[model samples]
Target: MGKARETILEIDLRALEHNYRYLRSKLGPETKFLGVVKAFAYGSDSKRIALKLQDLGIDYLAVAYVKEGVALRNAGVTKPILVLHPQAVNFDQLIEHCLEPSIYSPRILRAFLKTAKKHRQKDYPVHIKFNTGLNRLGFWENDVSHITEEISGGTELRIHSVFSHLAASEDLNEVDFTQKQIETFDKITTQIDHKLGYRPFRHLLNTSGIINYPEAQYDMVRSGIGLYGFGNEAQIDAELKPVATLKTIISQIHRIEPGESVGYNRAFFSNGYRTTATLPLGHADGIGRQYGHGKTYVEVNGQKAFIIGNVCMDMLMIDITGIDCKEGDEVIVFGKNPNADRFAATADTISYELLTGISQRVNRLFIGD
Candidate 1:
């Protein structure tokens, strides 16, 4: 990819393919791979990313909502899509679009069964979520009997898979807790198999789990951050390549004398002669106000320039003293050199928030099909 002529995000399909293959190398030959393309494919172009993943032969794709899945279908994605947090009201639309839902509660399960029966559908694939420890969403282990009873009552729904979330798979200090969660899930699956008289595919690993606990890769593994080139560990990060690179051009340059202030509320006061360059992106573009006042820095002419003053809604200023930069010069917001993870660390944040926080207003330029 070339340097930015304007504020834009460059996505490399080749990097995405590399990350996918790297993750696959850790899985068993028969284990399935599910690529998560939710949150606009982590703030990149979802339609484009989904298409690439489909062409790459991903076994399944996951989105966080029904509308996201529908968008994929509209974009000609034919692979199975799992809506991780579907609402009961959209059950009809979900069925109409052929998107699977992760049923986590009794009310939602009943609502979906009604919709399936209304459509006169048989064996409609549905994923059951058990709350092993995440506590965010899922049915309790004791709900197995309830779920089995509901399934036995009708044939409108079929448990295609059972899955749970990992609360702290990335934190090695939480190994004991994660193990307990895994053990609990195993027991839940056993009960589910006994009660239902059959076994549905089981999965309980996220991106970190895939790296830290490969032994628990049950039947399939879902990867979101890993697919986007972030493994959540320093050693693993070295093996993956970031897929998105945010870049902008220097909109203008300013010279400030000692005691002069810059930006709103005079947030940055110069103690000596200083030079700064402004860029055409700010809080609204996902570089939030939290990054201002020397909290973070951007690369200007291959040199680190710390952000000064308050980050505006559509503009931000970075001190460029001693740097040989001028108007319209290419500035790397975050990319391979610093990477999103390193850039986000300057503000005490993470790559996921930074990547997904990128606004839609920023133009996206794709490389490598």
Candidate 2:
């Protein structure tokens, strides 16, 4: 309820629940829900977030690595978890913890199969990721036959799901590309079904895909940012509530005269007499230097206080001129005043980056049930 640190990321569990319900409202009863708790649950206490979602009865959870999945398991998360990008080295630990992996390449598949066989795993669940267009991960369409053949040899392993990434699902202008991705995923999965003689769970929608292309919602949908209060579109964003608010109090204030400079490298030179506030946040806390030199701002006293000078490792200066604010006043980096989506736009980034960038050292305080 009170801040033990100068800067804190306030997480509203009720807002997160509202977002989950909002997104869930868009899906049918039979459809499954996979809440992505990767990247520290978009940088806001993944264990706590996942625990809440688990209690909410989300069908699955996803993390980017085996370590993250293990963390959830240790935190008492009993729901099925999908490690989106598993490495071969962690296969043993993954299986040890019952963490299913998304095998995208033949090398990974073979390696996992070997590990599973060695462990004498029976019906071990594994998801297959098809490239489809993202080109970041997943197998190509041509890999399906080889995959079916290779996977068929193993009775110990079972294909839990087949999924793909939607490259530009949020960009309506790129609807064609998203459609192509869906089509490719469909074609690849259909071929696999014919060869394997059974259907695995299929999903190919991210937060944006769920909003922009609901028709392509296969057996389930994966949502990361949507759970944290971003819908990738204005209308949809308006319907969701941001769950994390990065707030820091002004540690000190300075009155600079013309010709005086602020911050390291003198990146910001005072044009005239002005007031500035130093915050206990900087690049190390995920507010990169690119946000400096007047590019980004924080909300103070319901006003935009432009960030000035280079963001140091532990501090940044904000021009608080003409604003009624003082030391210890709460300064909103992103949240109620300037929503994370809009705030991130000022830096030519997204809410995901800003939220996940929050330094772990910054304390996190959770509110609501």
Candidate 3:
């Protein structure tokens, strides 16, 4: 007997390397690149991606929470890992793992400092985030003085970088807004630097920012989605090679009678004498139930097989009656034959949302040189 082909995401490490090198080349040599590995490397595999990036000489790695940083540490990633949104409770673990926290609000700043003091840490490294129009996180513009004071007076912590996120860096239509964010970030950086009598590595760019706001690339650039081969901008998309591909296999096929309904709630009814193939992957694997009603499809025998009826929790039914494939024939959820982006579009969403939404249960197979 042979191993059963199950739902899987094939990750192309070669493409990942290419994307990293591409983004690195776009930024100035002086500007450092911090690879964002938060959300399990955007729902692919964080530990693997982080290790690869570190091995490829990436300067830093960023995660949305302390636990994410801890995971990378557990995977033996030695490069500097920044917790982009650290909480007070995890401060101890973060420090224990040598993970740097991104100090956003004043409260987090104070909390992290307190934790540092409790641990008897001296000049521990951390980054300061500014609320340059994003207003999602980070200290406001008026808080520059307060931030500078904290850093200058702190005997236990060090500010490695002061950065902000761009809200509309990928939208050329919002040039004015993006430019305003850049100017504001620059102003805040200067004020903090001047008052503290010291300058930190200043960064104000994400993947899109690096391409759309090259002049704003200060001392470092945080590359997240771009490193996974998505630029999110029309121009850069052409240059990116999507690094991940999702796939599955048919577990069974059935011949059905006309008017017979299928799946939970009978969400799908047979139009006529028809055939359906049931796959082992469904909403449980990240293919949402919304994918039913012919809105989404899987490729079988190099042809589209529309998803019929309801997408089940652990199984999805596809109309494979017209396709020439066996019960165990491999079915592509999204890959070379049916691109993930195209499938995501069918779900009225972008590739990022779908890719990042995939459940962690699915296995990831790495393909690289």
Q: Give the candidate number with the greatest lDDT.
A: 1
TM-score of each: 0.99, 0.97, 0.96
Q: What C-alpha lDDT, on a 0 to 100 scale, does residue 132 get in candidate 3?
A: 83
| Clash count per candidate | 0, 0, 1
| 10 residues in a row with least lDDT, candidate 1 | 1-10
- Runs of candidate 2 with Cα error greater than 4 angstroms are 1-5
Global local distance difference test of model 1: 0.94
- Candidate 3's residue-wise lDDT over 1-369, tens digit each? 122388888888888999999998898788899999989898899999999998899998999998888888888999998888888999999899999889999899889888999999998988999998887998998998888788678679888889899998888899999988888888898898888777889888899988878898898889888988778865787787888888788898899999998889988888799999999988888889878898887889788899988888899999987789997787778865566677888878887788898888998888884
Per-residue CA lDDT of model 2 for 153-197, tens digit only, reads: 869888989998989998989988888888888899899899989
Q: Candidate 1 clashing pairs? A: none
What lDDT score is found at residue 334 in candidate 3? 80
- lDDT value for candidate 2? 0.91
Candidate 1 segments whose C-alpha is farther than 4 A from its true place? none
> Which pairs of residues clash in candidate 3, taking residues 3 or more apart in a chain or in different chains?
268-309
Q: What is the overall TM-score of model 2 with all chains considered together? A: 0.97
For TM-score, candidate 1 versus 3, the one ahead is 1
List of clashing residue pairs for candidate 2: none
